[model samples]
Target chain A: MDHYTLLNPLIGGILIGLASLLATVLSGKIPGISGVFGRLLVLATPDPPSVAAATYGVAGKTWRAVFLLGLIGGAALSFALWQSAAIFRPMRPLVVMAIAGLLVGFGTRLGGGCTSGHGVCGVGIGAKDSMAATLIFMATAMVTVFIYNRAIL
Target chain B: MKAGKLFLLLVAGGLFGCGLAISGMTDPARVIGFLDLLGAWDPALLFVMAGAVAVYGLGMLVLRRFASRNLKLPTASSSPIDRRLVIGAAIFGLGWGLGGFCPGPALANLGGLRAEALLFVPAMAIGMLLAQRFFGADS
Candidate 1:
């Protein structure tokens, strides 16, 4: 890869790390996208009263909403400024993308985290479960990619 | 939850988006490129993750130093390895492979208002909700 390509991921990684650090230090949160978003989903759903109600409370709900909004705002701002910051193309059919999203959503919840929570923040903290989850998911991702591109495609 | 904490959370979220966008993680092509290991594999994601882990690992150390505060992070799950974790991760990996976008980048790409990302995000939300409703037992 070119030097520019290498630099961008590193810089972005640092920014993400800083964000994770800030969230943990200031609010004792993990800045995990799935965890944060999942909590909001559970809260929004009209499920029977459960642990979430007591856990999220008023403050919990409020902060999560704000944090999610900030994610969009930050991305929008960067898009406007960078213009070419995001190169989004639909590489697969709509059905495929939708199904993928569903699996990701379900898997993250079932697994208790996503790339951000389990791979980044979880591994960073040296949590054994997170480490295991990351390793398993990483291997699976590679294998899936191999199968899709090589076998299926 | 408080105003100050809310503000901090907002900043954190924004910064997280910034990192994703800047690092090129927001681009599905880049992610797919990285995953295409047998072919023209891109190692950029490896470095991106490395940088993030370095900083976050240090942050964990700092938090550990302040362990007396009883910091109960939501990210911490005391559960062991089980069928749920393995199966869920495997399915998630398959989905990620099918669609190059992960939850974080997909959500962040909403900033650009990409049509495909729009389609993906809602579907993901529905999936999360479904999992919570049906699979709350497993978690």
Candidate 2:
């Protein structure tokens, strides 16, 4: 707690909110990372559904690709410009990371959203489903952490 | 017209990534610290969520006034809370708590070319494909 600071998080959070708002205003789509990424994967298959095809279309895929690319590029740019000391601290083993990734991918798809989708955009817009999903995920995460720290670690 | 939309999306995505980086959410340890309620908890993430939710909520309020056919906002799901939602979210939480990475941060980390992201992202994509295949595309 002694090393905690709020300014950066607050600023960063506002920027994220602005980004979500801009995406919706300009494209009329919720910038749910999981939905965008999941649908992109589906679209890449040999025989994508007509619904997905129609939804994504040519421009749809293009925007999704660029948006994702932008996510990577933005982070790179941030490191280059400021916070040069930022580094990834591996908290879990490689095996744990892989398993976690699998669960995240599966769960977000089945659940319909992630933090940006449900926690930010969904809860922001007062969607009941998003709210429910957020609460459940948050609580579950806390419980998991509690168990892991006490039992596993 | 199409190019304009794509450009805006790019900018939005960039800002979103930058925000994630700046807020320190890109760090798995920081995320885990927030979740470590039984341990020494960090409240920075709480403020981050508060700021994001408040600003986005207010923006949506103004946007709602001008809602039109052109504005394709996501509509609330008609279905009530079901098993899929609960199970899915719980599974996601387990993964999140374990890895301390979610879709947005995990993808963003790819920018740094971190080894963890390289491993995590591909596995996550595979998991997504598995879910779509087994659960049907609609899920």
Per-residue alpha-carbon lDDT of model 1 for A1-153, expressed as tens digits? Answer: 223457788888998888888887766666678888888766554545574464356666777778778888888887777745655555677788898899888888888888888888988888788888888877887888888888767
Chain B only, TM-score of each candidate: 0.91, 0.93
lDDT tens readout by residue for model 1, B1-139: 5678789889998998988887878877778888888878888789889999989988778767776666765445677888888888887887888888888898888888887688999999988888888777235
**Candidate 2: what is its chain A TM-score?**
0.88
Report the error of model 2 at residue A143, Å. 1.3
Give candidate 2's error at residue B93 in angstroms.
Answer: 0.4
Model 2: residues >4 Å from true position, as ranges?
A1-4, A44-50, B67-69
* Stretches of model 1 off by over 4 angstroms after superposition: A1-4, A44-51, B66-77
User: Best TM-score goes to which candidate?
Assistant: 2
lDDT of each: 0.80, 0.84
List, residue by residue over A66-118, the lDDT tens digit for candidate 2: 88888888988876666521546788988999999999999998888899988
Ten-residue region with minimum lDDT total, candidate 2 chain A: A79-88
